[model samples]
Target: MKTKFTAILLLQLLLISCSGTISTLKKEYSFNTSSSLKSNWNFNPKEWALEKDTLTGTGGPMHWGVIESRKQLPENYEINFRVNMTKESLFEVMLNLDKEKYIRTYLYQINQNIVIGDGVYDKKDDSYGKRGGKSLFTKPMELQNNKWYSVKIRVQNNQLYFSVDNKITLECSLEKSNLSQKGKLGFITNGETKITDLTIKTL
Candidate 1:
């Protein structure tokens, strides 16, 4: 009888934990009018423009258009969006960005940007990093040019959650980092990358 009671209690706790995660997610903000992205979000090169619904970031060194909002983001949050890469092998997102310090804060709740690129699983070192990089996938996992991929991210305290196309790939904790500063969310695009349907939500 005692063992049965313990099993029932454990089952109830599991259900409650699952339900709590399901209930905490809520949408916060979404963007429109990328054509006027310049007036809204901060970007360099002045060479880039919001043509229709997407911000077309051109390639090259200084031309690697960096797009980040001046608005400081909340402590724990989720960001979801779609990215279409064109002929480029890489792109990056920024989290807990300290523009003043030119670096990222110790990720509060997995505080790092979602970086999806060609494979490099074992090529990491102690300083292994992207947007304070957390993980890398295989070359086959690389984003295909001209194809749109859904990227979703959830950050809470010291853990970072990442998913692509509804497929959850990474959940990492920041061990070397400890700074929890709040800053703007941003991205730096290499090659031709277009961003659309960006939504930010609080947890």
Candidate 2:
């Protein structure tokens, strides 16, 4: 009798957990405008320490982030945005899980408006590591300071593709990344940066 009761209780708990996750995903959410930023998106403008507000095609945000726990997204998702930055500023975007413990990062920066390229980071070593993808590009991407570039990231299964303006730039794969599955999405910058039309679509 005791074993039977335990089994029944476990079944009930499992059903409840699955139902909760399904409900969370059913709701449609977006963050492009100020209204969306305040309602669904979670970010603190003060945390980034605002310098000034810049413009884009649509609503632009200085910085944005959402907690891993609050997000119930699919395993595969695409993050695309138009990023603009100054020569003195740096641009870094990442998908972080376990809060500040672990992060898989993709960075684009312009220093003195001279060199521009793609960078991957592993939080475990506190270092910038090599990128993972299928193919490699010969020339590094040239980014203009105070200008916007269309960036797209597609994470299908274990493969990741980074492209600029629908052009294939660098392709890499992350086999041992802690963020193997979907979690939190974060955009961070130290100097000055602007992001607009940020969209997260999942398959």
- Could you say which candidate leads in TM-score? 1
In angstroms, the error of model 2 at 183 is 1.1
RMSD of each: 12.3, 11.8
Candidate 1 structure lDDT: 0.53
The whole-model lDDT of each prediction reads 0.53, 0.47
Residues 31-68, candidate 1, lDDT per residue (tens digit)? 44543354446766563556554666665433445666
Candidate with the greatest lDDT versus the true structure: 1
**Clashing residue pairs found in predicted model 2:** 132-172, 132-173, 133-171, 133-172, 133-173
lDDT of 1 at 14: 64
Note the clash tally of each candidate.
14, 5
Q: Return the number of clashes found in candidate 1.
A: 14
Q: Provide the lowest-lDDT 10-residue window in model 2.
A: 50-59
Error of 2 at 131 (Å): 18
> Can you tell me which runs of candidate 2 are displaced by over 4 Å?
1-28, 32-35, 47-72, 101-105, 110-139, 176-179
TM-score computed on alpha carbons, candidate 2: 0.56
